[model samples]
Target: MSMTPPPGWYRDPSYPLVERWWDGTAWTDHRRQPEAPQLPLTQPESPGGGGSGRAKAVALSVAGVVLVASIVTGAVLLRRDDGSGDAAATTTETTTETTTATTAVSPSASDTPSPSASTSAPSPDDPSVVVDELNGITLPLLDGWVRPQYVAEHDIVMTTPGTYDCPGDPGLCRHGRVISRTVTANDEKSPKALAQQDIEDAANSSYDRDLIDNRPFKGITSHQEVKSGQVAVAGRAGYFVRWKVKTRVGPGGYVESLAFPSSVGSESLVIVRFAFDAGSDGPPLTDMDRITKGIRPVGDADTGGGVGSSIGPSK
Candidate 1:
């Protein structure tokens, strides 16, 4: 005769100390729960008749993830910006034909445009001024200085004879070369008047326009003024009228400039510009004074019909 278990008790008397009884369909109720816990109900190996092969696949996936993470970590260390020097250095022997000259002004002075008494000008549309005549360009303005060498390049507008280098280097491989082009009084309006307008116009006229409008040209960060001739270089007294304008250049790439032309001459306008990137290296203005003061125009002026020497312009 089979003995039926008690209503709440299904005793496994194999090692009977206290019995684990059934609570309805399962052994949930116990006289005293054991300290050495039993294996859980959800620990079934595989319901679909499989080994731990499924677990092995998951392990392999985790391993693959760790391997990929390792590879990325190695590459990142090699490509970091910390002390990588710029990409511009390695490929071209650190020499560029269109390098810029950069430096600073002295404590006794600054590159800043100082307040000065204004110089009055003739009317913009005065009949006495003939616009197009190459001869229309004032002559006496460059009387003492030599002729500026005209080179048809984008980075150069009109440079007196001198050497130009990039931001920090002593002298970029190119030496004894200067570039310039014909400037019109039509754009300038006042053929005789030497002002920042003529300098800005010269900057925006040719390939250098993209160099400037697209960038500070020197990579400066924060600016307080525009580029006017305030910072006077030795043997060349001048100022850099600073213009902090919002240009179409990329973000934080504003423009700053300073120019110094001989007081009265054909090559009387020298312009210096800086294009600043907020996140990059500091600007090249630290050694700019030596480079700018180094600019020297060669040859006498091609003054037109005695109009420039005696008076400013024909008009």
Candidate 2:
């Protein structure tokens, strides 16, 4: 802020006089000082030309002090941010002084975290659970079971595996799985259709007795529609029914009747019927009581009955 003008000219003090210029550092363009009227060491020119006595020196002194103070303040600010602070930090908007002052901390590789652990599935105690709506009960079914085959849709037929010629009369079997098994006629589709088809499928395929409708396949024994209702899977709607009962297969005997309502629901009233052919291995009474155990329907129906269809005969 000092305003010392470059040596140029100074107002001369003589009457009607003008100015004197300077060279390098000495007064130049000098007029000889009147030896008689000596030039005062320095003259305060009257209002017309000379400058002030002490004012100029004071101004220059103040400017020098201000410049020195600025330099010192800048240095301290920089040092404080650099690493002089307990927890020094710096950001983009920070003053340049602060940036020059601090440094970011970095950790060794060992200090970094290891990879995260992988997740696992539930154990037996945890019990993998799946909810299914059967009857009015929304319950869980066993998680894993070996299912030979299953389809969103299919037909059921019943027949006992019985053979005409064999050491043990290797029983014939109901051909439960087949296109011919596709549910057709309402008469052809009830639980009876299942029973009949089983016997037929078994006889036709294995026993060489195709379409043996001689004796109506032992009628499917239905207890009472234990529970029946409309159900849907992915929007496919059908009626579901469950029941248990006993029925006679041939002229001599009867077998246990379990309500095997696998097709609880379908497009129509799903009538689940389980019946064993009287002639099956066990005693007549035991045959009828077998329903207590799982009926084990092979095809559409358990072939223990004497039904037969193109699918196969029930075993």
Candidate 3:
């Protein structure tokens, strides 16, 4: 029986130090340095059997040999503790060669996409307003912000200049600036678990820093009454995080994310994020708050307002 990990990037169990893509079915050629930008899946055509089966076979074979070699090397070291140093050295060399040969056939982590490879310059066809069809919400034109027509190799949309243009780190770019697809939760999952998974996915790709350094604010809710200048997510209660990441431009790289359950205890999730350069004159937290607060399901309205409606902002 095959036990594949759920769809996401995880530390390659076989490779140990590197991360590999698990497209919910099998490992893919896509890999990266831990906490780096996640590369898109590049699956090659197989001769007859399935690609996943072949990958698993190769990985298992390599793992078995490596394990056996490690045991043998350990035993040799124990027995040679009081013996000649020359014998110990020879045994070590042989074991090292065996391990190297076993791993040489696998894909190199360097083949992963670069940060530059994952970004693109804005183009024409960008509309005056940004609409998220999935969530039935729309964003009117904000000054100095352009809707990206093409964000190469990433699922995230860049709503602002600093959102995905990390000269220092490229793999963390997000291009699908308007909306994200709905993430349906399984029966066993909770809303918080779903939110944490979203964060983990980001951390897995281009988020290699400590959570403490990110300075994430905890216990966020999606209440419309929270405050005037904070994120007001629609639907159910949600999770919020503010990341103060360092980039080449300055230490002003900021990422604010809002995630909420589509409804009370429902298995559906709705998440929104805002990335910007906060060096000195970065976008205010109120703006970030307004952006999220303005999101609402189509035809969904609050007592006083709705998304892109009469209450949030005057257009």
Candidate 4:
């Protein structure tokens, strides 16, 4: 039986000029020319039949140079045969280090973004004034009007001094009282219905009766009259009426009511009342027109015209 040499570089059986690598039991593709062995140090023969020290030193130097050259060539062959394995391993280690660093810096699940620092400005359509602490409705601030006060039940009042507060010289009363009220509407409400309600409400008011009963002169007769029509108040088409009561003291300052009927949840009536002395220096009818036109629901901009601007509800 023939025994095989251990796995290593050996002279090729087929090619005489190169050696091939044997892996344990099999021949591998790796092949290279065998590295030449370095010459052994051989001293020169002197006349005495033995080399002198100088000659031995020179031979040893030459042998050392050849040995270094052989070692360099063998190292090159070893590295060439190793192929891309080393570079691939180095690249894999570098990739692993980069991956570890990235994972360490990544944000965790508990991280949260910081909140913004600035406050926002007010919106143009937002309401500046709120009315009725209970049944709150909001609107923009009205020019030329004082702060509103919740006075009577279901009523919020605001007024211009020159109108509601006549210049003291007037013997009777003043006007320009802009009163707002939210009232429940009857099922058959229309522009005419608003006018009728205004007439009834004014005729029953104590203020109207007192003005009629307390006559500055005894001969004057007192009577209640309501003049109503479809007037556009605050760009809204609704029933507007002027309630006038003539007394001995002259025509009692008229009570003007402008009704804006629209649905808000289940409630459907928004009434604005204007009371001013007809004889005293009071607010003009135009002022009443402006107030009604400017009115808008909370957070809603004026949509060109107000409630029922084109036509009244179909009767």
Indicate which candidate wins on TM-score.
Answer: 4
Alpha carbon deviation, residue 217, candidate 2 (Å)? 7.4
Candidate 2 per-residue lDDT, tens place, 203-249, comes to 22221211111122232232223333333212222222322222223
Scored by lDDT, the top model is 4
User: Can you write out model 1's per-residue Cα lDDT over 34-115, one digit (the tens) per residue?
Assistant: 3233322221234454524322222222110112322332343233222221123211111113322212101112222221
Per-candidate Cα RMSD to the true structure, in Å, reads 31.3, 46.3, 17.2, 45.5
lDDT score for candidate 3 against the true structure: 0.36
Candidate 3's clash total is 9
lDDT of 4 by residue, 132-189 (tens): 3222233334565553321111132455432121121111222445556544434545
Can you give the TM-score per candidate against the true fold?
0.27, 0.19, 0.40, 0.44
Model 1 residue 221 CA deviation in Å: 15
**Candidate 3 residue spans exceeding 4 A from truth:** 1-129, 153-158, 161-166, 169-179, 185-189, 203-232, 247-252, 263-267, 301-315
Off by over 4 Å in 1: 1-195, 198-229, 245-249, 254-257, 262-278, 281-283, 293-315
Off by more than 4 A, model 4: 1-143, 149-154, 162-174, 185-188, 203-227, 231-237, 304-309, 312-314
lDDT of 4: 0.39
